[model samples]
Structures are given as C-alpha cells and as structure tokens.
Target chain A: MKSGALRASVQLSRSTFTLDVDIAVAAGETVAVVGPNGAGKSTLLSIVAGLLVPEAGRIEIAGVAVDDVAAGIHVPPERRAVGLVFQDHLLFPHLSALENVAFGLRSRGVPKPEARQRAAVWLERLGVAHRAGARPRSLSGGEAQRVALARSLAIEPDVLLLDEPLSALDVETRDRVRSELRTHLAGFAGPRVVVTHDPVEAMVLADRMVVLEGGRVSHDGTPAELTRHPRTHYVARFVGLNLYCGQASGSTLDVDGGGRIVAAPDEPVEGQAAATVRPQAVSLHLQRPEGTPRNVWPGRVVGVDATGERVRVEVESEPPVIAEITPAALADLRLASGDEVWVSIKATDVHLEPA
Target chain B: MTTPLPVRVLAAVGFAFVLLPFLGLLQRTPWSQLPSLVTRPDVRQALRLSILTSLAAMFLAIVLGVPLAWVLARTHIPGRSVARAIVTLPMVLPPVVGGAALLFALGRNGLVGQYLDDWFDIRLPFTTVAVVLAQTFVSMPFLVVTVEAALRSTDVRYEQAAATLGAGRWTTFRRVTLPSVAPSVLAGAVLCWARALGEFGATISFAGNLEGRTETVPLAIYIELQRDRDAAIAMSLVLVVISLVVLVALRDRWYRVQG
Candidate 1:
C-alpha cells in the first residue's frame, strides 16, 4: 500500500436509480467530482468514505483493500479512517471547536491532554485558534466551515471527502474561504475528493475533474483538458467553450457556416466529432486582415453578456460562436450588439474536428 | 347585541360552571378543620405512600422510555410503525384495564409469575411493588409520547457530526441526544410523576387499598368521601394548594418544553 492512493469501482442499485463508476487518485492530489443535480457525485464520495456501501464493487484506500467481494471484507465508516466535511458544516452545537477536533483523537486511544494539544496546533495552523471555545451556533457560516475542515484534517485520515464545502457561504465569502481551504488542503499529504458543480471551483481547487452524468462518468481528465475540449455538451457549456460541428482534413477545416479553419495534424477522427474553442481565444477585427491564417468568419454580434470585466459576445455566423473579450478590447474594436465584424483566429486557436 | 351572542353566552356559562365547584369547595372547605384533617395519622400515611411509590415509578419510567423514544425517532429499522403502536398502547388503555393486564402478567396465578415466585419466593401482587407497577403501567406512556415528539422534531445533523468526530453510538446518545432533548425529558418526567401521584383505580384494584401500605392519597380520599365528607373536602383542598404552588414555580419551564 502506498502512502495515499485510492482505486474504486462503485456500483449502487436502488429500485429507481443505479450508479456505477470507476475512479482512481494518488497522494497529495485533489480530484473534483463535478456534475448536475442527481448525478451520483455525492453518492460516490459517500461510498469512498464507507458511509454508503456499493453492492457489487471493491474499494481500496491506500491500497488497503477496504472492500473485497471474495474475501467478504467490508469496513464500516467508523473504522475507515476517512474524514468527511459536509456541505452545511455539520458541527456539533454542544461541543466547542477544540473539543470537536479532539474527539477523533480521543477515540483512537490518545490521552485527552495530548489530543487537545494536537487539536490546538491544528486550529492554529488553520488560523482559527481564537474560535476554539466557541460553539457552532455562535459562529458565523465561514467560521463554522473552517472548523469543519480543521476537524477533518486533525484526524490525519488516509482520504478526505469534501461535499460542496464553500456552497453554503455567501458569494463574497466563498472566494476567500476557498483560498483558505486550498491552503489547508495543500498541507495534507493524502488523497482528497471534492464534490462541486461549479466549474470555476473545480478548476481553482482541484487538479483533475471527473464529469458525472446519469450516475456515470462522462469524462475524466485534467482541468486544462476539460476546459479546452469538453467531451460532452454538458461539460462544453459548463466550461464556457464554443462548440462547433465541423469537418477536418489534412490541414483544412470546414463547418456548416462557421466558415473555413486550420487544423493541427492530430485533429479528431472523422464523423461527428466536436470542435470546441475557448471564448477568450477568438479575436475580432473590423476587416479581414491580409495575413496567412486559417480562419476568418463574417458575423453580426447578436448578444453581449458582461461577465466580470470581460464581455462575452454571441456572434450569429453559420454556426453561432461566443467570443470573450476584455472591456478594453471590446472598446478598441468598437463592438456592440448588431455590429458586423470579421473574426480571425490563428491555426493554433482554430481547433477542428469531424462533423 | 347588548347581551352578546348565544354561543358566547353559552361558552362563558360553561366555563363558570366548571370553576364554580372548585371555588365553592375552596370557600366551604372548613378552614379551621384543615390542619387536623391533613395531620391525622391515616392521612399522613396515605400522602407519604403516594409520594414514595409515585416518585419511584416515575424514575423507572423515564429510565426505560427515553431511549425507546430516541430509537423510534431516528432509526430505519423494519416494523418501526408496529413498534410505535405497541409503545402507545398504554396511553389508550383504561387505568382499570391496565391494572388488570398487569395482574395477569405478574400476579401469582398469572403467566411468568408462578415461576418468579417458585424460584425466588417473591410475590408481586398485593405489595408495594404492585403499587409501583400499576402506577408505572398507567403513567409511562406520557413520558414516551412527549419525548418521542421532541426527538422527532430535533435536527439529526448534530448526531452525524458527532459520528464523524469519532463518538460511538452510546457516547453520542448520552452526551448529545440526551441534552438536546433535556427540557422535553424533564417535562415528560414531571407529567409522569403527576399522573402516577394522582393514580387511584389501578392502585386500589391491583395493589388493594391497605392503610399505611397501598392506600394512596387518591384512594384515601375516596374512602373518606364515603364516611366523612368534611374531612375529605379538607384533604382535597390541601392537595390543590400543593399542586398550585409546584406548578407556579415551574410554569415557564413547562411552557417552553411544550412549545
């Protein structure tokens, strides 16, 4: 068994629903399970933590073989040594933050004084030592969430499960708390599974993303891979990628009406493969530039969605594409809704695929 | 319009009718005879016995009923509905019928009682234990129903947090579940004690009315009512005053528990 490795193939069967998934993770790594509602992402985390049992598969945490069908070895949650941080930060209202952390250590035969000392160090590391004596109800949402994370980490479990830890906070507090959570996770030398439906959260907080849909994994890849070429329409829309149904040859590309584009040698195989372009990669021009490039499409801007400081323009070409540009860039290009412009993309940016 | 509506008149009159007896009894209870009537040897013995057996019965009921209520409100076991129905059976049974059931279950001539006596030579019927059993049988459901309702309404997330912190089931129950339902538990125990203290039919029938033994205050009052009406009225007045004083002192706690 390695210090931190988890390999699991979980199968859950109920009267109306079934979930089957195969996943693996390594030490000091974070895998974010992202999906829509009812995707079994939470169920997958629960199975790994031993809170929920999978009927027909095995689970190995740190290669320990916690669940093996032939040996009939299925460990219960109490003995699994996995820490779970619930979405609502389920802190015990009666116990103070310090005592809550010490509870796990005390259960493992550590003396009360020693457990309290270890818990105090953990609280200090998480920068929440001031809240050691406060009960959960008296603490704010952000404060309680930190306590939940500290309590889980204090146990030093082999695996960690975080179920939407930042979703319960206000939008303003989510960013700061997520960064703080990232710091706490960085110091953990164990495998971690974070479940969130937010693409930005999954990207910022996890090394890899697994997209679950209809109780199965639709795609599994790094954040960059998932962002650049989302295999499914769900992931495409989630990552804000502009998808086009197009065809590709040696170095030329053609779509229904998105116009001609260039292709890299390793373009996708023929027949109905998707072409995804990041909105930020599309450059707008007032006229077709006299340059050696693969793609230049004429389109009218149909809609403009101002996201953060960047404006996302939806262009009505043969196959519509959304281009994200900074406010400065939009102003320089003098772009607005109903503006006719030539959009030029380089061969590297004009990604191609089979129609 | 000046006389008020017929329904309002009838409601006010009905309330007055209910209060008139207590008020009249208060005014006519021969204040001069109250002291000697309550201080009499027989009266004192009945009061002491009532308080003793009722307190013991109430303690026993709370000990056995609270965990059962917690299980009913939290677990996912099979036949939970059936288990709940059995728990509430005593609440629906008449006090006399409950006493009869206790007799058939633990009496010398009944099931399991013969062996209990034959093995240990212990007879439960017609003794102090009989009085405790009868009171408990008719009063425990009050505690169970109240605690069960409280447990049902409480948030169970705290328990899950305790488990993640590595507290076992028993530790969680003692430190978390009990305290969470503390006020309700106290309220239910108070109700059980009051019900047991005022019990009459079961104690009189199953344990039999023996002076200084099974003749509780309610049974003594019944016996005295047949002989001397004035003394019984004086005894009833004393009981009312004691009840009012206890209730006034803890009225706020009781209301909070109920809400």
Candidate 2:
C-alpha cells in the first residue's frame, strides 16, 4: 500500500442488482467514475465514504484499512477521514455558510474560534467569504456548490469524493462551477474520486476515467485513450465514434452482424479485434464515389440530427454507421431521414483495439 | 375559480355550525361584570395554575416526545408500527379514559404508584404534578405525531452528509435533524400547550381539581357555570381568544403542510 492512496475492492448484492468493482488512486490523482443510472456509481462513492458497508471488500485510505471484511474491521463513517460532496450540496439549511464549513472541525473537537477561523479561510479560498453569513437557502446554486466543496475540503481528509458535484446547478452555472472545481481538485493533495454520468465532465475533471456499466468496470483509461479506442457501446457513442468488433485477418476485417470493413492498424491484426472510426472520419454521398477509401457501403439514412455547426447522420446498414458532416456538406448531399446514401471510410481512419 | 353554489352553501352551514356556540357564549357574557369576574382571586389562581401546568406539560412533551418521534421516524425496531399505534393512541382515546388509565397506573395505591410510594415515598395522585402528567398524557401525542411526520419528510441525505463530515450520531441529530424540523416541533408544542390549557376531563379524574393545584381554567369554568354564569362566560371568552391566537400563529405552517 502506497502512502496517501485509496484502494477499494468491493462486492455488494441486492435483490435486483449486484455491484463488484476494484479501483485504486494514488495521491494527487483524480479518477472519474462515469456510468449510467443504476450502474453503481453512487453506490461506489457510498462504500468509499463509509456510508454503506460492503459484504466483501477491503478499503484502504492513506495506508489505513478503513474496511476489511475478512479481518472483521469496519470503521464507521464519522471515524473515516473522508470528505464527500453530494450532488445536491446538502448544506445544513439552518446553518450559515461559515458554520457549515466549520461543522466538521467542530465535530472533530476543534475549538469554535479556531474552527470558524479555518472555515473563514476556506470560504475565502472558494471565493464565497462574503456569503459566509448567509444560509444555504439564500445562496445561488453555484455559490452553494462552492460552499459544499469548501465544507468537504475543510476537514482535510485522506480522500475526497464528489458525487455529481455540479449536477444540481443550471447549465449556465454548471460550466463555471465545473471549471472552478477542476482548479480546487487539482490543488488538493489527496486521492479524489468524482462520480458523474456526463462524459465531458469526466474527461475534463479527471486524470483517468473508469467506465462502470451494469455494476462492473467496462473500460479504464485516460481521456485520450478512451476517445481513441472506446471499448464499450456506451463509450463509443459517448466519444461519437462508430465501433465494430469482428475477426481480423491482414488488412481486411469481417465485422459481426454481417458487415465488412478494411482497416490498417499500426500493428498486425490477429484473431479477434475491435475497430473504431470517428464520426468525422465517415462521409456520406448521394452516389457511390470513386476514391482511395477502402470501406464503402450503401445504406438508408435512419436519422439526421443537427448538433451545433455539424450534423450527425445515422446510416442503417450492416453494423450501422454514424457520419458527422458540416451543414454545407449535408446540403450538398441533400440528406434526410429514410434516404438511400453511400457511406465511405478510409482504411487508415479505422482504429483497432485488441479485444 | 369560484366555488359551486351548493358547495359554498354547505360550507357556510358547516362554518355556522362551528361558530354558533362561540356566538352564544358571547351573547351570554355580561360585559359590565367581565373585568371584575376575570380579576377575581380564584379565577386568577386557576388561570396562573393553568399556564404553569400547560407550559410544564409542553416542555416535558418536547424533552421526551422528540426522541420518541425520532425513533419512530428512523428506526426499524421490531413491532415499530405497533409501537407507533400505541404512542398515538392518546390522540384517538377519550380524555376521560386516558385519565383513568393514568390513574390506574400512577395513582397512590395503583400499579406503579404503589411501588413509587413504597420505594421513593412519592405520591402522584391529586397533586399539581399529577395535573401536568394528565395533560401530557392527553397532549403529547400531538407533539409526537407532528414531529414524527416532519422527521419522516426531512431529506435524510443531510444527515448522511453530516456523518461523512465527521459528525457522530448525536451531533447529527442535534445539528442537522432537529433544526431541519424545528418549525414542526414549535407548531407541535403550541398545539400541545393549547390542548393542555383546555384539559378538564383528564385533570378532573386524575388530579381531582384542587384549587391552586390542579384547578386549571377549564375546571374553574365548569365550576363557575353552576354558581356564577358571568364568570364562566368571561373565562370561556379568554380561552376563545387564546385558541384564536394559536390558530393565527399556526396559519402559515398549517397551510404549508396541508398545501
């Protein structure tokens, strides 16, 4: 066990679902746990925070065993030096922002004057010192989020856990608070775990990302790695790439569900491989085009969605493909839903990963 | 939208049914004698005793009922539902029956009372303490029910947040849970106090209505009605005013819960 590290391998079972995961984070590292609802994202945070006990697991924080099921050791939540920032902030409605931040210090036997002094410093660092006297009900969403962050940080715990910290804010406030959170998280020396369903938040806030799907880790990698070679369907969609798995031999690949795509990877392909093509790498044409591209197929356009300056066109073919094109290209092709279109992908643009 | 004519008419009749008794009391009140009647020494003594006993009952209810409310709201003890039913039984039981039950359990020669007398030389029946006990017996359910409902509705995530922030169970209860339901506790105490102020059947049965001891305003009113009707009407007017003040004070909280 490394000093100032968090290591947890936990398994819990319920009537409807089961969660099994192993995660570790070194000091000064932030890991984002991203998953769909009911994927045990919040459950993982709860277990780490000592709010929920795992039936079988060992959790070590800063080289101290907070929970070891086999050893019959389980430290209660109050005894575990863990800071948790909830999705809704959950600030004490009766307390001022300063008192909220001081709560942990006071509970730990810090004198009231010293607690208030330290709390004031944290509130100042979070840029909400002026709002210290205000109750949570009066603060704006972003202000409340900052206070919640400060309250958690004030305790100076061994590990920091944020469960959708910016999810309760409005879209306008969410962007600013997320950036501010990134700065604060970077400043903290402890291991940090942030749980979020938003891929962008995970990518922007965390040094590495863990994809939890159906209560198990499906993929774990850096943002660039995840974007380049997404392992799961959810991740592929999140990265806006069309992915396929199939048998690979030489430069030709036979995709599952009756599709064929030619791929040229940096390494030679073997028996089983996964291929990913960015939406931008795919192209749509009204007629079959003569080009150096190795992969081309005719398919009916199933959906057309306008996103900002570009449009995403989903073509219903064998191993369906999504192609992103500019509005000018869309107009040039005269694309619409249910229209027959030809899809093309260059062999070099199809990235492969070992299955 | 305007209410339907039939509904409005029926509501008016219901409202009148509730208001007619107050109007009758007012009509019988001798305005010239009301001041002197209320200032009489016996009336003053009963009034002061009523205030002291009712306030004591409210305080005792809070000290004991809040913890009971928390247990009912948060715990999963066996037979919790049955325990809750028993705790709230006083709300539905007749005040006379509750008084009799209290007497059987706590009267001088009664079950627990005999033990108290033999071991501690404590006699509870027909005392000022008995008056407070009877009032608490009949009114504490109001407090417990209100606070329990508030605790049930509070977002427990705040308590979880407190625990994660290093607050122990007692600290979480004191700093988070109790303050979150403060308004409900206050409203419950006010309701309990009002109920205790008007207590007659319970005090008469258990405490025996001793002047300056257990003879609260309600008991005094009952006694005055036979000998001095004017004094009874004056005391009834005082109670009516107090009830109105309580209603006004609780209007916002009541509507918030109802709405």
Return the top candidate by TM-score: 2
Instruction: Estimate the overall C-alpha local distance difference test score of candidate 2.
Output: 0.91
lDDT of 2 at B238: 88
lDDT tens digits by residue: candidate 1, A38-135:
88988887788776778888999887888866678788766777889999987766789998778788766689999999999988888889999998
Instruction: Give lDDT tens digits, candidate 2, residues A13-73.
Output: 8565688999999999999998778899999999999999999989999888999999999
Q: Candidate 2: give the clashing pairs.
A: none
Tell me the tens digit of each residue's lDDT in model 1 across B19-82.
8989998887888877898888888888888889999999999998898887888788999999
Scoring only the A-chain of each prediction against the true A-chain gives TM-scores of 0.78, 0.90
The 0-to-1 C-alpha lDDT of every candidate, in the order given, reads 0.82, 0.91
Could you tell me which residue pairs clash in candidate 1?
A: A272-A355
Clashes (backbone N, CA, C under 3 Å), per candidate, total 1, 0
Worst ten in a row by lDDT for model 2 chain B: B250-259
